[model samples]
Target: MFESAGDVIKPKGDVNAPSGLQSVLDVEEAAEPVLPHFFPDEQNDSIPRLSRDTFLDILDGKYNEHYDNKLIIDCRFEYEYDGGHVDGAINYNDKELLASHLFNSPLEGRTLLLFHCEYSVHRAPLMARHIRAQDRTVNAECYPRLNYPEVYILEGGYSGFFAEHRQRCYPQAYVEMDAAEHVRTYLRFW
Candidate 1:
């Protein structure tokens, strides 16, 4: 009697439904809830801070097979750096000079970057933060944003490192000089 009009379609039983032909609403309802993929919203005060021992390990190649690309920036006066500094550290007293150097030669594939002054309290963290800011701004302009290497500030600065690893220090000038005099001369501001 129902076939007199033509043909009538009937809903299939759940057992007879096609394997991959489920309705969109049913699929969505059955799917697991999705979670966001992003960093937590914790307030980052500044660049990451590395302890003196950790910094020394990086310098000594404990973390990587090779330590050639690692850079240690000494953000102190040129005279102070010349007097004595870390073995392979580069002097960048002025922010402008540091920024210019970073712009000219990007640190894309570097393994690690360490920044320190007399005390890691101020200059090192400040410069590290500046470098991070530059990376964010400059990478934004590129077609595919560049991934900057991680930057760190030495926790206690050069003084702390020197006290612990005097053997790794360079030039013998500062190492041989009077410790008290050195503190008064270079670390007075710190």
Candidate 2:
């Protein structure tokens, strides 16, 4: 389904996926994910799933054999992210902007892109879906092949992951998005 270089994983010009890869827009409109993902949805958009334990493994270098690097994209409000986030995670909440940048970016290397918000529910999945859609459009003529094919969503999101892996977080703390104390901070973020 994909072609792998030392740093960049490119899909083979030809791929044989069961569902026959297509853009996310094929199933849903250009709507961002809302509400929590209490149950899995039917949109099998091909975005891979990554477990928290496996996330830790990747951080510990277990996936070095497959991915040369990884990027943790925290898609929460700026305040929520600033309060606490995965170590080394970059805060990028705008899906449209992110997609535009990723498609046009000159970033090199094969890297696993891990996306998440408070829960691995809405924002995270939607952003991943958007990126895939934009990627499809960018390489429409080429079909299934993509510039960066290794996109994943961290299961249970940061809340679940941080609960068990606090030691791995930057400041070893987790902050809820609705915390009362950040009311003033939220305004600035907005």
Candidate 3:
């Protein structure tokens, strides 16, 4: 007498359910994507899945210390880089001419490459794939933002730098202004 439910019943021994309709929960879960086993766990539709802590370790020189020279590439536009970026990142934004500048940089096989963008958007992974396709055996990875050991998305791009590690990432600049002092300073200046 279950007249209200449309999909509460499972046909006996039936296993070939449509993937499009799998959201009903009763449908079988699809096998995971065929990415590498060590793929980062922090990924989403927007961000790639990467281990947060492992990302930090790499940024902090753990991988470089162990391996030879490594490369960290910033894939944001020129204007974005002009604003700010990770201390030593190399700028690789060539605008709409993606084909012209693609693979122009000679990445070292012995080096570990880390790719970052404002939010890792089209740039980070794009470069990663290009790098891999060039030499299938090259060692490479990507990070949209840098929070270390735990790679994180820059919630507000570079502005997020202060939000994530206000005290640590920017020790000298994130000065705390007292509420009264803040109001007085603003009012007095105006």
Candidate 4:
């Protein structure tokens, strides 16, 4: 199945073809980006899913009792937010803002932080790293290890989210995050 914006997320080749399609895949692989899965098959129900309809429903009060005042952070570009975003999500422009927000916001209570940006996987995780680092820097009321609040990466990123179920207004741009080593190679070559 195609991700919302027709960005192929699977192994690039056609999975449906009994004979796997092959192509030159060039996305830079990050180091240890996908952490070891502690729960193999088990689902973590704690991570919230914010689909278009569900987001709208929450905004319309259908799920207000369960969702009101929870934080939803959209990491998309400014134009994207101005064009449209889920009803209540506040925009955190880049990784820096993400870190600052995490450092400043109270982490003691029940709040959900949903991070989304154009369906690319790297930005959210980078932002997560910054957020986690903030926990260590501050004398967190919530223990950094024991009970840090939950932060979620929106499935499919922004393109996946929008393309999967909603109409996208802007042409989707592909932003790839390279591993540190690859970045070094660029610097060396140039």
What TM-score would every model get versus the actual structure? Answer: 0.63, 0.71, 0.44, 0.49
**lDDT tens digits, residues 27-77, model 2?**
433332221222346655566667787788877877677765668899988
Give the per-residue lDDT digits (tens) of candidate 1, residues 1-190: 4754343465436756566444444422221212111221353555667767677777777766542367789987666688779899998877777877777876545346678888776677678888877766775534233334456677777778778777887764453223554666556455
Error of 4 at 183 (Å): 21
lDDT of all predictions: 0.65, 0.75, 0.44, 0.51
Rank by TM-score, descending? 2, 1, 4, 3
Query: Per model, how many backbone clashes are there?
Result: 0, 5, 11, 7
CA-RMSD of model 4: 22.8
Q: Model 3: runs farther than 4 Å from truth?
A: 1-49, 95-109, 137-162, 166-190
Measured on C-alpha atoms, candidate 4 has an lDDT of 0.51
User: Candidate 3 on 18-100: residue-level lDDT in tens?
Assistant: 55432444433332322121443454432334343454555576655444554556666554555455655567754334323
lDDT of 1 at 182: 66
Worst 10 residues of 2 by lDDT: 30-39
List candidate 2 segments past 4 Å from native: 1-45, 183-190
Best by lDDT: 2
Supply candidate 4's per-residue lDDT for 67.
Answer: 29
lDDT per residue (tens digit) for residues 1-190 in model 4: 5656657544667666653333324322222211112221344333333444444444455644542246667775565565556556687766766666555665554445566666635555556556656655663332333223445566566666555544432333333223353465335433
Model 4 stretches astray by more than 4 angstroms: 1-68, 105-108, 139-148, 167-190
**Best of the two (1, 3) by lDDT:** 1
